[model samples]
Target: MNLYSIAIQQLTRQHMATIEALVRQQPEFDRVEDLADRLRQAGVRAEARYVPAEKLFIAVYGDIAQVEAALETLCRLNRLNCVPGSSSWQLVHQDHSITQPAVLVIHL
Candidate 1:
């Protein structure tokens, strides 16, 4: 796990036992952060989170071409395995467990 994950866990375990943030399943967050990391490595600005939803989404603010490329990369890396969705951001999967979700805040 990354420092981000560890830190989040510690904070929640110590400070947020109740409902303070949206938690996700382990594999779900894993894939999300992994996708963010891969995108960063590819020089694409992106992240994964749910502002107030039930699933994670890769929030991107780059050129359309770059975003498309990043999405393609995610698919190739087996990250974006989202089923055919009826939402704005199709999720890789939906697991609403209470665990720290990987939220990559890529500061522009």
Candidate 2:
């Protein structure tokens, strides 16, 4: 009975978590699309986007273990030499900052 209860508790607490990392790359770097495609092929839903000179957000949403595994694969494939947990997210845009919708905002 004790073992069964423990197992149930563990199962109940299982939930999905998201892991994000800013892909800091230079103008010459152009592997965003390829990386996103590879991650999708590996069964991980990843979004690799470049918001201009700002940050390249790479977000993976899945189970904790799966996310960790995907993150590892991402690092291995991308050759990210930075330490883990070293990067943090920063808000590049705010709702009040821009009055126009993103579709209307055009960049040169």
Candidate 3:
């Protein structure tokens, strides 16, 4: 498997308990600051949130290319497994859980 696939497989084993803890404490607000900072530096209007269901959601309004690049950088640095979609990027986390769906939506 390629490096990307390897990373995806690795996260599939992440314990859901950690995700649940994040949702309760809302620590993802601090955790995603780097991503938000990168988007803002690229002149994009962005916000990052951790849903109560243990999902990570990042919304960006700006040039599509810039938004995509920023997200790419974030994923690379954070070792996140993200698959690009038509209107958003599906961030694959643990596959064993239904509540940890991480998604990044781009707005023009």
All candidates in order of lDDT, best leading? 3, 1, 2
lDDT against the true structure, each candidate: 0.56, 0.46, 0.66
Worst 10 residues of 1 by lDDT: 80-89
Q: How close to the true structure is residue 70 of candidate 3, measured as C-alpha lDDT?
A: 74
In model 3, where do residues sit more than 4 Å from their true spots?
Answer: 1-25, 49-56, 93-101
Q: Which pairs of residues have clashing backbones in candidate 3?
A: none
TM-score of 2: 0.41
Better of 1 and 2 by lDDT: 1
For lDDT, the strongest prediction is: 3
Point to the candidate with the largest TM-score.
3
* Cα lDDT tens digits for candidate 2, 52-86: 46535555556545655655666566544323442
Q: Estimate each model's TM-score.
A: 0.48, 0.41, 0.52
Task: Tell me which of candidates 1 and 3 scores higher on TM-score.
Answer: 3
The residue pairs found clashing in candidate 1 are: none
Position 7, candidate 2: lDDT: 90
Candidate 1 lDDT over residue span 1-108, tens digit each: 999999989987966643434352556667677777787788877776655444555666666566556656665665333333222234342344533343433223
Rank order by TM-score, top first? 3, 1, 2
Residue 84, model 3: lDDT of: 82
